[model samples]
Target: MALATVRFDAGQPVDLEDSLLGGQAHRWKRASHPELVEGEWYSGVLRGVLVLIRQHGQAIEFLSSSSDPQAMIPRIRDHLRLDDDLKAIQAEIAGDPNVAAQVERYPGLRVLRQDPWECLIAYICSANSNIETIHRNMERLSDEFGEPLTLPNPQGEGTGTITRNAFPKPVDLAEAGEAELRRLKLGFRAPYVHQAAIAVAERRLDLAHLVAAPYQEAKAELMALKGIGDKIADCIALMSLEKMEAFPIDVWVRRALADWYFPGQKTPTNRILLEWAQRYFGRYAGYANQYLFHGRRLRDRKPAQPESG
Candidate 1:
């Protein structure tokens, strides 16, 4: 096994637990029970663990423990589009004095660069569900369907251990019946997951096009999938497809804007909110919105319900 360490500068705000990927780990936890080996980093929440993460070509052993993640991984290497993405977002948000103020509050809120396939299914599972539930479902799905990896336990003799290899691919999930998934406690989302997996597996939905397609065109295409609606589509775009301009508007964002920006009024309709985000926040609309989401959620410290797109 290979190991490495990195540290964050003093006063540099970074969350290793939530840093490398999106801070939300329900999907990651669902995907694998990666061993958590803890050590001090910036604010002291770094872990050394083994997980199957793709690196350019094949799934390789990753010793994912962070110190100062901001200074460790070249930001550009962490995100394939770091330059254009940061530039676009910074410029777009600069137009809005209020949004700019919010961005200034959290210098670390960057849109995550995740594998496209993982992003798609994760967000699909996200529809009308809370993060905790999402995490459980992801874990259960992997335990049931994903490939598994086993390694020797450091403190034991021949008493080895096992963890799922990775998130199950669309084909893996598609092969499952609703009854089987229901047993895992997916509830009403079972069929949706089953069918979505089949669609992607069958090449009915060509997700590869998302890599270079215009954001709107890509979003419209994602929306064509049954379980994927506007919000989920945008999530796939922003988090998965690398569309920095994609803004996923959910109830929290709507309420946040209404409470902070609009005040005492009904949250703007989805269409109106979308327009406002694009017009006001511009190219980095997705990045700005993520900061707003993260900051607002942390401040309120309440779980917001997911709404239909």
Candidate 2:
């Protein structure tokens, strides 16, 4: 790796593993399966931005600006803002004694912050799918439509190609037919993807504003899209737009919540989970749900706990 310094102004705190791995951008190409250890630094692309992330064991380092890294360090140290308000969210979810116990068991878990555009399309593909399949489909989409970037081998081996740009703009996808996407093996998501791209390209839909809009309005607008349902709508609002109050209920969260609150009971429906989350977790409900989701998926069977105050 070249000796270059990078700077990052973390408008909000970032969790590399949770943010990158918990969703569609999981299958990163490396020269070798480098043994990731604490404080280990590696360079890769996240959401088309070149970043140098350090595995601090507990948390990851994110460099958003690739200018003088040494000079950027002090600025980032001074500018980075942790969302400690999540503690209040944790308390709200923890109001239920059992949920509190689970939260206590997995303290280091946090909500992932991803690029809004990528999160928008990625979660749209997430409907009725598994992580592994989502990863495969995302890779295929990149191979088919995403811009190409050459990457160096982390192990000092030969270079390789990985999707290096944002998911194609909606116009780009609108140029292709459903058959082309189907060829990428998107399965039933092909038409959905095509129409979404068309929607964005034709100015029929607006995705960026959802981030700043009120949660309810954002959810309503997202749901108005052809393929989006309630769950996917909430996902766009929460993950893409950074609406912390938006609670997205997927099968895993439903299972976790059911196990915690109604053991031996049938899995709760998405509607019920959403209502419960809004009532119990309040504004930070989305943050708490994210932590719980990552804890369950990435860290084996453990529940997410909060860091000590």
Candidate 3:
């Protein structure tokens, strides 16, 4: 099990810590140096893959247990969105002065392209919650239903004692009873997760195909599932399917738009804000959304309810 090291020189725009912890994903947990067998790092299940990630100055590394670890590089790249040029994307979304200022402040914030199935359940669980609770719920879901894997510590010296389960696959959760799912403290979201898993497992929803379909079509299809709405659909489209034009409007985003962009004015409707973003930012509206999201997150320095979008 070799480690795949992807590096960016000092002063490069990508910041792994910001990208992982910036409210976009709730599953990544802070790991200690001894636990990781390296310096302090993070651990999480990316799709079905268990990865140990660390950042050393300009270098970002992915350690996976796949026999061909190099293959995981592209998968990680797509998941982490390392291929997209940050400067170019920022330039595209910086048309709005408020967003431009955010880009400058939050330098390497990028919308991660996560696994569609995992991304779906995650956002579904995100409604009216905080990141801490979201992480707890996700971990419980995985422990109850996901498959297990064994991976070495960073030094290949020994097996680490951190979590070994991956995020549950659709089939894994397809037959999960709502009562059992609710044991994970999913609240009212348990039935929604079961129904969504059934949809995917039964082939009623072909999530993989949607990745290449038109953005609107994909979003419409996602919204058709139980518990999915306009904001949730857009979140899945932008964060999971690489649809850069997808703009998800949630509470933080709404507040950001109201205070930063239109201070002392009437807060526009979600539809109007989204439409304005689509036309103003064009293909990179999602990245713009990240900056505003992260900037506001940092500025407020308080944990807000994680809207399901």
Best by lDDT: 3
lDDT of predicted model 1: 0.60
| Ranking of predictions according to lDDT | 3, 1, 2
Candidate 3 lDDT score relative to the true structure = 0.78
Worst 10 residues of 3 by lDDT: 2-11
Give the C-alpha lDDT of model 2. 0.60
TM-score of each candidate? 0.75, 0.76, 0.91
**What are the runs in model 2 whose C-alpha is more than 4 Å off?**
5-15, 24-44, 57-88, 151-166, 264-268, 298-309
Which regions in candidate 3 have their CA more than 4 angstroms from the true location? 1-12, 33-36, 155-161, 304-309
lDDT of 2 by residue, 246-280 (tens): 87777567656877766887866778878888877
TM-score attained by model 2: 0.76
lDDT of 1 by residue, 157-219 (tens): 444443334577788888887788889988777887787788789988777877789998999
> What is the C-alpha lDDT profile of model 3 across 71-188, one tens digit per residue?
7767767767777887887877777888889877777777787888888888888777777887888888888777886666544455554456888878888777788888878998
Clashing pairs in 1: 6-68, 7-68, 8-68, 26-135, 30-138, 30-139, 89-284
